[model samples]
Target chain A: MSAPGSALIEARGVSVRLDGRGILTGIDLDVRAGEILALVGPNGAGKSTLLSVLSGDASPNEGEVTLLGRPIGDYRALELARLRSVLTQANAVSFPFRVIEIVQMGRNPWMRGSTVDDDREAVIRAVEAADVEHLLGRRFTSLSGGEQARVSLARVLAQSTDIVFLDEPTAALDLRHQEEVMRVARGLAAQGRAVVVVVHDLSLAGAYADRIALLDSGRLDALGTPAEVMTAERVSRVYGLEVRIHRLGASGRPVVLPLRD
Target chain B: MSPRIRAVGLTLLLAGVVVGGIVLSAITGQLAITPTEVAGSLLRAVGLDTVWAPTDPIVESTLWFVRFPRILMGLLVGAALAVAGAVMQAIFGNPLAEPGVVGVSSGAALGAATAIVLGASVLGGAGIAVFAFLGALLATLLVYVVSRAGGRTEVVTLLLTGIAINAFAQAGIAFVLFVADTASREQIVFWQLGSIAGSLWSQVAIVAAVGVAGVIAAILLAQRLDLLALGERNARHLGVNVERLRLVSIVLVALLTGVAVAFTGIIAFVGLVVPHIIRMIIGPAHRGLIIASAVGGGALLVLADLLTRTMVAGAELPIGMLTSLIGGPFFFYLLWRQRRRSGGWA
Candidate 1:
């Protein structure tokens, strides 16, 4: 699909209007294989909206989305789902499912003709990949919010599709879980999966993202490598706060730290 | 717990209860028939002709026709309501939802009440069932419309609105009950308080058709429901048609509940209790939960009815009263346990 390693996701001038107001406007972006594209912006900057549209979850009012060179609307629901997996913002539900049951739901889109053995192997690997092996047998409801998020990541990983969208995956995570999640993200990209993530942590984005896409006021503020895009001026303008960009001694990549008033 | 253990455990429990309930129901009555006589009577009615000891029509009729059909109707309606409760709990993402919570049961009652008031039974065979189905379908639509005003419904909000609508429907029934004559009053009491007495084979077939259909449909939709339990926005992100699933489930619950109330009147407690027990045991996987709820409900209601009819010779207590006597405390127990487990006032 889409030349095997070429742009797997292409959005052409897409815009989204929620209720009666425009929330996202004229967004054009493409994601390719073995690439981690980080979407970063202030709250309500349509970062999540852009991600949702790109993942083919929500429909856009003004433009078209093509994944793997085919119109997204033309693909069957399970077909589209089999090609991509999404981990949304931190959310909770009332049902008290077990951790394994939660992970097994990931196999639904692909379990149409597969054997039971296939699904079991995928689930075990996914649980291990998310570093939730210790938490596998525990109750999902009894877990803390951060722990639940990790289990949810295990679920999405069990889905094991070629495209992944992570919306603020590390927003609620502790420092260790944050690194653990992004390491999984990077690993997926390394395996030729197109991974697009919306991360609030600028430093994490600097370290993990192949290219960063910055959104401001429903517009693309900047899109480039961490070295080219994450300037002190750009951070100050986008966030309306003073910021400092420091380069790591080993990698020479930008790391942002905010300077508060 | 492992899924296998849960499945086998529920199966054994439901089987023991069902067999015991059947035996108890078969023996309890004014007729004073032996277990052998009752079995022979049933077998002969099915054309065995082996029970040749002067098969008095009255005794035979009461045993083969009355008690058996009543038992079958109880099983059908109970299973329908209970499975509906399980699905509703999953769909609404609230543990408290059952057949009665979402106005489906009340709507069914209203339909039957309307049929009784209108003398639809005079039109013969299918009239009561038709009117009941219409009443249920309409009430479900109303609940859905009110819940959809802002384009989404919180589980709590939908449940509370269901309570309000149920209260309003009952008020209408009360209005009808107020102006009715004595014969109709007895009929209304029987219909309102819930009873399996006076059930016929014809009615059993009708309720079973709709109830079984609804339950099977619900079980089939369990996979999609897994995605739905992720909550609305995330469910949509996972490529599930959330609105369509909601509509289908609500309509199915309505139809099954409508047919159930049309025949069995208004049996309560089974729906809510059965699902709660299943969830408590299995930790809320809809696939197994729905099936377990159905089997458990069928067995429980049958057992409750068996006790109700046997409690007094020559007279039957209201089946609903018996269920409430047993189920009310059980309901409170669940609330207490859930509150304790949640470790808060929620």
Candidate 2:
């Protein structure tokens, strides 16, 4: 409804091939700042692959990607690192690093000649923002799945990048923690950064994303607001399951439920 | 304590221990020179006027020609192995990875074997050193190239590749020994067992130059290595050139490993254990880990060499055997404790 915000990232006719197998094909998308774009799809639908290409984690075999009007491949690693940060689904640290130490790693890009005082302050602020200050002294390997996820989020937040790509950041969290994580994403978007979240939960996507891009077999099946994309017919057709879209009266958010024959 | 202060303190402490180990190693032998006199002789030999110097020609020659070169070799080899281990662990993202265990040292051994048995020469005097470095770099590159898939390397792949390469290199060494004359065969066996017993000043000088350069390069790459531990995808996102980092790190690891192995033979556990011990004390920050591992490794080898020399009367143990005998148990302890704490392999 609001005029689309300025495009921060543009992918034109992008495709990815690995080991002679095509993983993503002809995906043209514009990710705009001040918006949360949720990529939702079934397993093996290439949502993660698309996110990787957008975040410069994987190079596309065909087509072009530009971030902030420059080809993604043209930017230096350090320069690109200052502009984007990615939170991968798996965060396994081999060493027993402290939680604060893990979060401090986020400041690595800015640590060139930066004082220790500045680093400590940035780490503390990121910890508070991610609400993981209580776990600061704890070893990362000692933390629970949810706690580690939050600490990892804090690490990404410490990067202070403009474009954030989070791949299933709430996959290990409880309902409350899930909401907390999604709230952080929304808050980041509100601060004028483009946030792309790859998630399996349609309800969370519906609640937080300004637009949902439904992917099926490496193609964009549908892309729009919840009401425009989450109709029972399209949901059933895309997911291959009968479903009902229930609208929450107060917030008018669509919730999808599978219907029995 | 602040990490900066802690790092500085740890560096100073390790430096003191290394110096102490060198002095202890220098004085305690069959001839039995006094520790204070040994120090004075060393300082005086280096043109520094000291309060005490060995007046006897035998003592002076013993200090400079015999003990000093061997001790210096031990120090350089120890430092090189440990620094290489730290860099390998960081690059491979595994605590257990090391040059000897991962076949890089054996690759160097094979190259050195070719030079010794086949009489290959590349740089006249530095022939063996050049071949060993080339062999080490090639072997590591082979393992890395084989393990990497889709722009990422898996630790399991690295372990597996290392095992295969190590076995292959062992067979190659065995073949070389089989083809050698009786005297050459004995020399090859002694070399394989790894001892600094016959260290020369020329050998010490070569290891020192190469080892110092490799160690310094590893230290400089420390920050990038820390970023790389975040996984390749995440590291790339954070503006690290993952491919470049991996390439440079492997080359440096090979250079360090090759130089140490060329001089000392296949000293296994120093590279594997020293870094792990330092990580336990100082945590896994490579910036500090690299420096501490260098000093700690040097001290450890000096101590090991001392053990080899003194543990038996008139007959010294092979340095490699002593390291493995000590390092194997220490590795198991670390593994068991880690399993108990994490309840899984990290």
Among the numbered candidates, top lDDT falls to 2
**Can you write out model 2's per-residue Cα lDDT over B1-346, one digit (the tens) per residue?**
7566677788899899989888888889999899878878878878997778878889989888889899889989999999998898887777777888778999999988777776654343267788789889988888777876644445557668888999999999999999987866777788889999888888888899999999999988988888777677677777788879988999999999988988679888787788887776777888898998898898889989999999999999999999888887876786677567657653
Model 1, span A1-261: residue lDDT tens = 333357988999999998978888898899888889999988889999998889887779999999888878787667877899889885575677778888888887876777899899989988988888888778788898888888888888988888989988897789998998999999998888889999989999999999999999888989988888899999999999899999987766788988866
Task: Assess each prediction's global lDDT (C-alpha) against the native.
Answer: 0.80, 0.85
Strongest candidate by DockQ = 2
- The CA lDDT at A112 in model 2 is 84
Q: Which ten residues in a row have the lowest lDDT in candidate 1 chain A?
A: A1-10
* Over 4 Å off, model 2: A1-4, A17-22, A113-121, A249-251, B1-5, B46-51, B120-125, B147-160, B181-183, B332-346
* Chain A TM-score, each candidate: 0.95, 0.94
TM-score of each: 0.93, 0.93
Worst 10 residues of 1 chain B by lDDT: B147-156
Q: Which TM-score value belongs to model 1?
A: 0.93
**Candidate 2 lDDT by residue in tens digits, A48-113:** 999989987678999999998899988888888888889998887756777888898898888786
Query: Candidate 1 at B152: error in angstroms?
Result: 8.7
